[model samples]
Target: MTQELVAQLFGKALSNPILDRMDDAASLDIEGRIAFTVDSHVVSPIFFPGGDIGRLSMTGTINDLAMVGARPLYITAGFIIEEGFLLEELVRIVASMRDAADEAGVQVVAGDTKVVERGAADGVFITTSGVGSIPDGVRISGSNARPGDIIIVSGTIGDHGATILSKREGMDFEVELQSDCAPLGRLVEEMLAASSGIHVLRDPTRGGVAATLNEIAVSSGVDVEIEEEKIPYRGEVRAACELLGLDPLVLANEGKLVAFVAENDAAIVLETMRASRYGADAAVIGRVAEVESSRPRVYARTLLGSRRILSMPTGEQLPRIC
Candidate 1:
């Protein structure tokens, strides 16, 4: 049955008969260093203000590969569809995926589909795996942050999480909030070109900027300090976060990135990012520091001349948020 499903989803191959075996894994031949990343999207209401699962899946995977200074090339998607899922909605998703892939200049070379009993799955769950090539002389990682490096975020935070929460909870806000679900490869490319000594590049998804910074601090064995006044947040998102007792820093962001670069090149890098479509709100929010304590920590400076520790999220503040 699975073989038949595969045949229906992907046509038969002529060269390799083993391809018809419907194996769980697919092998690929490679040359230089390759980067691979996988992500699953289960955003509530599937159809949100800015995008759906299909576009989110593509962007998420592409951005993951791009964060490490990799040029994304291809993606493989696996879809789990509910039995009663609407075919029209599925078509729309596929179209959106195509559009996203085209915009990213990546090919959807492979994919799979499976149907589950109605209640067993949500409307649809998308898993995307992407492969990209890392350019020579480019090294970027979470552990590369150094003392005196300036941190810059691509854009405003909490848009994606706020949009999802509003739609899921059916709360009407004064302004229309849209999710910042966007591809960041181009933005990363611009930043890399403007400066070569980029210490780290991280997309503040899942647990948002706070969790991302904490992860970087621990990995790089350095202290990070951010001024709350410098972090950008939309008014509507701020109001929503207040109402829900959520910190905007802890909310998820899909279209934002945190970059660590040398202090001298920070302004040029920020200018490059600001010129790009995805990074208009780019700002130098923080800096890396050598930790004197036992473990690395993230600290935020408030407007009232107070400091607070930023830690990883304890529990799911919001569920099914991409």
Candidate 2:
């Protein structure tokens, strides 16, 4: 893209003081312990029900930092566009990215664009790197769960994954299913303030809540026990998954987070989460079971009073649902 075209394309859509500078690189003065993460978005239908690739890129990056208990600060986006991609569509995606960044209170400090031959790549793919500052005394990680820690989900699961599946496969259930794509920085901050005993904070993305809890269990050397009836999932998402022969537990989520907090603080944390904007349907799904002699794992109790092992996904259930 020429200087003028680049300016015309992004000079205004993603214009921030630092981004508008249009220098070779960006300089940041982030302070304290910062959480830095990088992610790429290639969801098949670049523009899904709730958001586009641009919003997905920014929100996913910011949420990754939020998962680590950090307040997001800055992000850099790189776009790979196809040769025949529509300029109008490109502008819409950029505008989505700008809106998402503004809502999340983060800056798009730097970015790069590349055009590939026709059919060389998807219509558009975005890669974003984010940086955020971790507040003092707030230590959250996938490896921090303990026996008796309570597992709480921020909201319904499988929304994002199911929405993509619905759009990709042209399955609509009359109810418009949209991806739960939203930034959770403020939500995380609220939970942290409610209690310092939050042990684990993880986003159930590609592998869903089952994979995330299993990871926490093994990493923290504790067994996990969840109730099937307690896992919150939307009606439309469940319907879509059933139609698609997909497992809701294994579906991805973009705006959902699973938190493992100390038993004493569990109630307060869940209450705080419920009060947050993105946590209206928050539910306490399970708890860390007593550690066994073997490697830690996850187990789910069915509504019929039966228990079953919740295994880690041997492979991807649905590729590129992020």
Candidate 3:
């Protein structure tokens, strides 16, 4: 069964000579400054509206590397399946991973598989680790954001979380919602090409934009202020969140990214992002400012012309919506 699963992964899309060797470890020929990232996906329904656990695991790790201004090169996957899981389902998941990898131009160089007792695990869980090469002279980090930097978000927020919540609760909204689960390597590259002044790049996944910006503020010792009206969000998703008593700012997003760039080059970066497929809805939502207190802060100016503190999420609002 393990061998069959491995063969399925290597199906037409993924053809890597190193992976075909079936070795305990993959021999990579990468050099220069490299970025390594690992992520685990355990969304409740292994299959979601726009993606599955397989695609999530792959793109999540790939996005992690891209966040640090790296070009994603290869990824490795590890899967844990519960007993009695259908072979057809596994094949479907593997196909999703292949398609994502192919789209991102990355190779799945190695993997591991394990099966457990029926009640011991979910239908399936996936862990992915990715390697990427950072270009020369590129420097990006959470702590790199500085006062006068402009903040831009890739697209509409909360789509992924809303889609998952709607699916799990069986609540259908007036408009269809799909998870923004996409590989963002290409988008990051374009942003890099547009500006060398980019200081920070982040994918708002689990805690969404609020959490990510808060982390950046603390790390960089800067205060962030954004206009609530400027942040892009689908009207249908907002309505759904209001109906469900949830906050869209804290919702998860799989494909979107938040970039902190120098004010001088903000226009070009925003232009570059808006030109990309995943970043069509890109908007400059805010700016970083000198911190007033020893502890940095994140503030959102509401549509009512009032300021409110955007605090870090204390607990997981939606469990396993990754």
Candidate 4:
């Protein structure tokens, strides 16, 4: 049924030349180069403390394109509604999506709708595709990180994952926890403007910072050394992870970004990110290094003066976490 639905919905090639391939999103070659990215949200329970699937779908795709150094322009959303879904709930989701797109200064130019059998689908699943133009002379990719490049994170980690967990299990903590879901095109633009030497940009999503760093290390063929003390995390989040037997480093974050920049430009890039709305808590957490023969992999220096491997997550720490 899922396969059939996917074929029925996206099987037809898009009319636009750039959108015909049925990729994540459509890329158009206008006067400037453009990039597109799409993401689907099936977060369990749909609504969480700080965000819902609607806003998450929008922000996820927008951040994907922004990670490539593009300025978001437009977005299209498609919602699959279940047969018994509440109309009021649907309206609220749409309203949230609208508000998120508006905050990002992107338009919802087109969309589609479909209803499935009550049990065949979840309450709601939202898919959003975003289009953005890449400024001339700006280039960013996971493979661009080189030895000596510095790694910086936009803010404290684990907020989204911890928040979702708290809501899912009905656990109460002293401090409020909210999903860090947010669009980051503006922050990316500022980083680009600050320096053209920005090497790699990625938002740690599904597998969190650990997975993201592992990907970069393998892609760039370099080792990453992170100072454990430098990686920021809220006290509540850390305590929650300890209680839940989870690693904060492997927790997902929606409004966070990981950037690899030239060592010389690291200070300016950090300053630029800190100035952005989404990056006020940004910090340099690590550096790229030559792959060591003994332990040529991602590692973190612990507060105890020992090194620990920042390995890829074994499995879904939190399923339907996005």
Q: Each candidate's root-mean-square deviation in Å?
A: 4.4, 2.8, 2.7, 5.8
- Model 4 scores what on Cα lDDT? 0.84
TM-scores, one per candidate: 0.90, 0.94, 0.95, 0.88
lDDT, residue 18, candidate 4:
35
Q: Which ten residues in a row have the lowest lDDT in candidate 4?
A: 10-19
User: Each model's C-alpha lDDT?
Assistant: 0.84, 0.87, 0.89, 0.84
Residue-pair clashes per prediction, in order, are: 0, 0, 0, 0
lDDT of 3 by residue, 1-322 (tens): 4646645554444557878877889999987999998888899778888998888998899999999999999998888889788888888888899899989999999887788888999898889999999999999999999999999999999999888888775554545888999999999999999889999999999888999999999999999999899999998789877787788999999999999999999999999989999899999999999998768999999988998999998777753332
Using TM-score as the measure, name the better of candidate 2 and candidate 4: 2
RMSD of 4: 5.8
For candidate 4, write residues 210-241 as lDDT tens digits.
99999999888899999999998998899888
Give candidate 1 misplaced runs (Cα > 4 Å). 1-31, 170-175, 318-322
Question: Using lDDT as the measure, which candidate wins?
Answer: 3
* Collision pairs in model 2: none
Model 3: residue 136 alpha-carbon error in angstroms = 0.7
As a whole number from 0 to 100, the lDDT of residue 190 in candidate 3 is 92
Comparison by lDDT, 3 against 4, better one: 3
